[model samples]
Each structure stands twice: as structure tokens, then as C-alpha cells.
Target chain A: MAIDWGFALRIAGFGLLLVFSILALLIVITRVVTRFASKKGPEEKEKKEERE
Target chain B: MIDYQTGFTGLTYGHIILICVGLIFIYLAITKKWEPYELLPIGVGLILANMPYTGLLLTPEQAGGVPGVAGLLGIFLEFGLYKYTVLPLLIFLGLGAMTDFGPLLASPKGFVLGAAAQMGIFVAFFGALALGFWGIADFGIKEAACIGIIGGADGPTTIFLTAKLAPELMGITAVAAYSYMAMVAIIQPPIVRALISEKERKIYMKPQLRAVSQREKIIFPIAVMLIVILLVPRAAPLVGMFMFGNLLRESGVVDRLSDTAQGALINTITIVLMLCIGASMSAELVMRPETLMVLGLGLVAFAAGTAGGVLLGKLVSRLSKEPFNPILGAAGVSAVPMAARVAQHIGQKANPRNFLLMHAMGPNVAGVIGSAVIAGVFLGILG
Candidate 1:
């Protein structure tokens, strides 16, 4: 089969973009979830203060 | 006169060469301790399969239509590798069970480093295609993709992708992946030192990461599974199973399942997978110009990946508020503890007070998810 240089370039370019984008989104999600989980209850807040 | 075919009669120059190659693998494993768990079995399997008249590689039909007995290695290759990609995925599940997401949660920018490390995969993908363009090798897009994933510095991801897109290239690619992973100590340091100055390497990171709460730990796998799978549905088989295994570990409720997946389950699958990988390398398949080309391209992929991660690490270090050692970026190539250890070793060499191992692991584990995501992308586009 003949090689399609244009198509191959797209796979390289877009494949990388997609990988970064997805992982970046995971980073955002992780930050949000951790923030929310850290603020859930007074008991947890008291425990955090004690540890600090 | 008795009519019986002796093993010596069937042996030829090609078989002899393969046997020697197997012996070299054994020698490396035993003497050099180079990936002994894998290389040793691979060596034994390669030797066993090449021994002519053993019927180790023959199916029932090939064995004169025998009903009771069949080739053990042949069954493994067909079922474990070719027919179903169960073994590699199960390996991922075990890896997930063994992984801890605390470091990644403590420092999220490592995600960017992890993604950057994957640049080698794409670079090698194009390199393989360029060989075809130059009329140097007969590699298709699928073959190029398989060769490229070796940059991820992951064996199971390489195997899973190759078995899906190009089964013909599995043995060579797996060997290339493992060999480079073993050589991380040699390959990474030079690239890392060249990219980051001694001043940058001496930068210190605090040893204590933010204590991750149990609730956050439980939520990580589920959230990753949902988001990643929704974005790249094709990644479900690998990402799904991997996260499921992590959930088993973190949930703290399924100690039995978690222990089994991490211990007995992964060990059993690894033996079968490694042996099958070794057995697949016959004389004719490996003794080709393309095989050599694939090996060369795999090295290019690995080097390019290390370069990509370190370059990004330099940028992140310059921009971040907290001190960051660029050497930590080398761990983003996803060789797991080995890559992380290399980063820690180099950092300490520059300054005795530096402790980068815990910080380096953030990108190290992130690289695992990064590579698996890219594998899903390739399957979605090319498969």
C-alpha cells in the first residue's frame, strides 16, 4: 500500500493532542474532587486541624 | 532399520542461530540479571521452540491429527496472544492494583510531563513510516504504530497494541520494549544530563507529599475510568481493567481479590505471556532485515521519549513556584520505579540533600495512564 504522508502526520499530531487533552482533563478532575472531598464534614476538618 | 526422525536431522543454520540467541538471553539474565523474570523464560522458550522435532510449536492437526496431546506453547500463543489479548490486559490489571496514586494527586502538573513523554511514540511512528517512504522497509501504518509504542517504555501496552494492530510484529516489539527498559540506566542518564544542567539537577524537592485521604484514593480510579473511557471508548479494555484493579486495592473491602490480582493472578499471566512471547520468535520470523530495522527504530523511539520529557521538565521547573528538578521529567517515560529511581539517583549525585523519588513518581505513574490512552487512540484510528 502507498504511504500517505499527510495522513500519517495527522495521526501523529492529533494522537498526541488527544493524549495530552485527556490527561489534562484528568488532572483538572482530580484537583476538583480532592478539593471537594477535603471540605466535606466538620469531623474531617477537625482531624485535619489536629494533624496540622 | 527403525524409521524415526532424529532432532539433529531437522536442525539447520537458522535454528542453530536462534538457539544461540536464546542462550545469549539466558546468559544475560543469569549473569547480568537483565530482566531475569522475563528474559530467562523467554530464553528457555526460544530454545525449546527451536529444537526441531519437539512438536512444541505444532497444533493438534499438525501433530498428525492427534486428539489427546497438543503443543503447549502453540496453545499459549494462539489463546493468550493472538486469539484474545487477555494476558497483557490482565497484566495491566495487576499493575493497577500495585500502583498508588498519592504522588500524582499531590502534584498534578506531572500529568503534563507524562503526556509529553509520549512524544517519542509519535516520533517513532513517523520514523517507521519514513523508512517505508524511502523504500527502506516494508512497514505499513499498523506496523509503524506498533514500533512507535515501544517509546512508551511499557511492555504490556506494547504487546496489547501490537497484538491488536499487528500480530506479526509482537515478538520483536516486545523484545525491543523489554531490552530498552532494562537499559534505562544506560539510555536515560546521558539524555537527562544533557538536557538539564547540574544546577537544575541539584534542585531539591520536599520528601513529604500531602497526605492523601482514603476517600480521595477511592474516588481517583472511578473518576479516571469514567472520564477516560467516555473520551476514548476504545481504551475501555485496558484503562477499564487497570482502574478496576486499582479500585480493588483502594476500596479496602476486597483484600482477597486485590491480593490475588496483585500476587497469584499477575504472576501466572506473566509466565504464560513471557513464554508465549519467546516462543513466537522462530528463526524465519526474526532473521529478517525488517526485524533489525524495528529494533533500531525502537531505540530512536526510546531516546526521543526521554528527550521530550526532560525538555518539558525544564520548562515546568522554570515556571513553577516550588522548586522542581528537571531530572524528574525523565521518569515520565513510564518505566515505573526504574525511571523514578534513575531520576532520584541523578538528583542525589548532583546534590546529596536532594530527594526527588516521591515527586518523580507523580509523572512516573501518570506516564502509565498517558501511554494507555495513546494506545487506545491508535486502536481507534488504525484498528
Candidate 2:
């Protein structure tokens, strides 16, 4: 069988793009959710309450 | 005059060599404590499969003519791997259940390191193609892809991908993946040291991570599952089960089920999966030029992965205002806590104040998800 170098390169290139894109999306979601829902650590809570 | 048949008479040099190899694996597992969970069972299976006149490798149909069959490892190979590919995915489920996503959630940037480490996969993919292009080995693109995934430093991912694309290469790839995983302590330090300077290794960030809420923990797996699977639906079997397992752990609602998935279920699947992988390595199948090339390429992939992670680690460190150790990038190859532990070990060696374990884990677990995503990509394109 004739090896298709073009297709092989495409799989390598596109596959990586897809992996990066998906994980990047996960990171974005994580950052957004944590910003909204993450519980402030004790240190942060104490300082914020003192300021209030 | 009736005579009883014996395996001793049928045994050849190939069987003897494989038996010796199996003995070596057993010795390493027992004495050195090297991946004993996987190596011990695989060693026993290797010995059993290579024994002449043993029907352990025979399919039920192949052994039907015989009055009775004792060695039935072949059944696992037929159904668990080739036909259904259930065992590896189940192992992923158990792994997910056991994993704590806190580190990853606490430090989202680890996700990028995890993705960067996967560069080794494509490196090996292209390397295999080049070798084949030159008529050096009989590797097609599918075979190259299987060989390439070993760089992911994930045993189950390698098994899952290989079984899907090229079952013939499954045993070799699995053994390579686990063996390299066991050698993470040995493999990663040199690559990390070479790439990272002593000053960078000494860089210390605060040990305390931002507290992730119970709500955030619960939302993570569900969110990841939906986003990843929607984009790469082919990953459903792996990512779906992995996220489901994590949900069982993080949800705080199904302790009993989660306990079973993490403990009993994973242990059972590991035994069956490792043994079948060992049984597949008959001498004729393993003793080849291509096998040697694949092994070499696997090492390259692993090293490349570590390099890729560290390079990205350097870049991320440069960009961030906080101090970050590039050595943590080495953990992005996804050998689990071992790779993370190696980062911590190397960091402390450089400076006692450095505590990179929690930070390293962010990339460590992300490597798992990243590899699975790549596996899905391979399956989507090639399968």
C-alpha cells in the first residue's frame, strides 16, 4: 500500500490541534467556574471580613 | 504401549527465552517493587503463554476439539481486548474513581502543560512514518499511531488505542508503556535537569492552593464529560467512563460504589488486562526488528513528552508573575503520582523550601485527560 504522507501529516497536525482545543476549553471552564464558585481560603476570608 | 505427552519435549529455544524474560519480570516486581500490580501478573502470563503444548492462548473454538482446556487466557484476549475492548476502559474508570481532581482544578494552567507533553505522540507518529517511508519497518500509519501513543506515558490509553487501531501491536505497546511508567523516576530526572537550570528548579511557589469547593468538584467531571465528548464523541467510551468514575469519587453521594470502582473493580480489571497483555507476547511475535524499533521510538516519545512539558513549563513560568518550577512540567507525561513525585523529589533536592508536589499533580492528572483526548483523536481518524 502506498503510504499517504499527506494524510499522516494531517493526522499529526489536526490531532494535536483538537487535543489542545479541548483541554484549553476545559481550562477556560475551570477558571470561570472556580472564579464564581470556589470557596475563599481561610486567609482570604479573614482579610475580607475584616475589611467589611 | 501408551505414552503421555509432555511440554518439555515440545519446548523450543524461543519458549525458553520468553520464560526467562518472564522470570526477569517477576524478579523485578517482587524484589525491586517495580509496578508489582501489573508486572507480577504479566510475568506469570508470559511464562504460561510461552510454554509449549499449553492451550492457554487457544480460543474456545480452537480448543473445542480437545476434551478439556485449562489455560483460558485466550478468552480474555478475544473478548476483553479484540472484540469488545472493555478491560482498558474499565481500568480507566477505576483510575478516575481513585484520582483526586483537586490539584487540576486548583491550578488550571496545568492543563496546558498536559497538552504540551503530548507532543511526543506526534513526534513518534512522524518518526514511525519516516521509518516506514524508508522501507525500514512494515509500519503503516495505523501501526505508527499505536507506536506513537506510548509517548502518552499512559498504559491503558496505549492499550485502548492500540487495541482499537492495531491489535497486533497491543502487547508490545502495553509492555512498553508500563515499563516506561515504572521507570519514570529514572527517565524524567535527566530530561528535567538537562532542560531546567538549578535556579529555575529552586523557584518556589506557595504550598497552599486555592480551596476548591464541593460544588466546583461536583461540577468538574460533568462539565468535562459534556465538553470533551461533544467535541470528540469517539472518546465517549474512555472519557465517559473516566468522568463517570471521577463523579463517583467527587460527587460525595456514592461512596460505596466509588469505593468498589477504585478498589475491587480496578484491581480485578488490572489483573485480567495485564495478564492478557503478557500472554500476547509470544517469542515469534515479539522478537523482531520492528519490535526493537517500536521500543526505541517509545522511549523517544516518552523523553519528548517530558521535554515538551518542561519547555512549556519554562514558558508558563516566564509569563506568570508567581514563581514556578519548570520541573513540574515533567509530571505532565501522566505516569500519575510517580511523575508528580519525581518533580517534588527533584525540586526538594535543589532547595529544601521547594514544595512542588501539589503543583506537580495539576499537570500529572491533566496528562491523563490529555492522553485520552489524543487517543480519541486517533480513534476518530484511524478507527
TM-score of each: 0.95, 0.96
**lDDT for predicted candidate 2 compared with the true structure:** 0.91
Native-interface RMSD of candidate 1: 1.6
Q: State residue B130's C-alpha deviation in candidate 1, in Å.
A: 0.9
Worst 10 residues of 1 chain B by lDDT: B59-68
lDDT of 1 by residue, B1-383 (tens): 99999889999888899899899999999999998888998888888888897878775555665775668998788778887889999999999999998899988888999999999998899999989888898899999999999999999999999999999889999999998998999999999988899889889888888878788889999999999999888889889999999999999999999999999999999899998888888887888899999999999998999999999999999999999888988999999888899998999999999888999899999999999999998999998
Candidate 2 positional error at B306, Å: 0.3
Per-residue alpha-carbon lDDT of candidate 2 for residues B1-383, written as tens digits (9 for 90 to 100): 77877999988888898899899999999999999999999899889889887778986656674656635798888889988999999999999999888989999999999999999999999899889888999999999999999999999999999999998889889989999999999999999999999899899888888778988988999999999999988889889999999999999999999999999999999999999999989887887788889999999999999999999999999998878788888999999989999999999999998888999999999999999998998999899
Candidate 1's error at B357, in angstroms? 0.8
Where is model 2 chain B poorest over a 10-residue stretch in terms of lDDT? B62-71
Q: Score the docking of each candidate (DockQ).
A: 0.60, 0.73
Q: Local distance difference test, per candidate?
A: 0.90, 0.91
- Tell me how much of the true interface, by contacts, candidate 2 captures: 0.77
- Give the per-prediction TM-score of chain B: 0.97, 0.97
Q: Which residue pairs overlap in candidate 2's backbone?
A: none
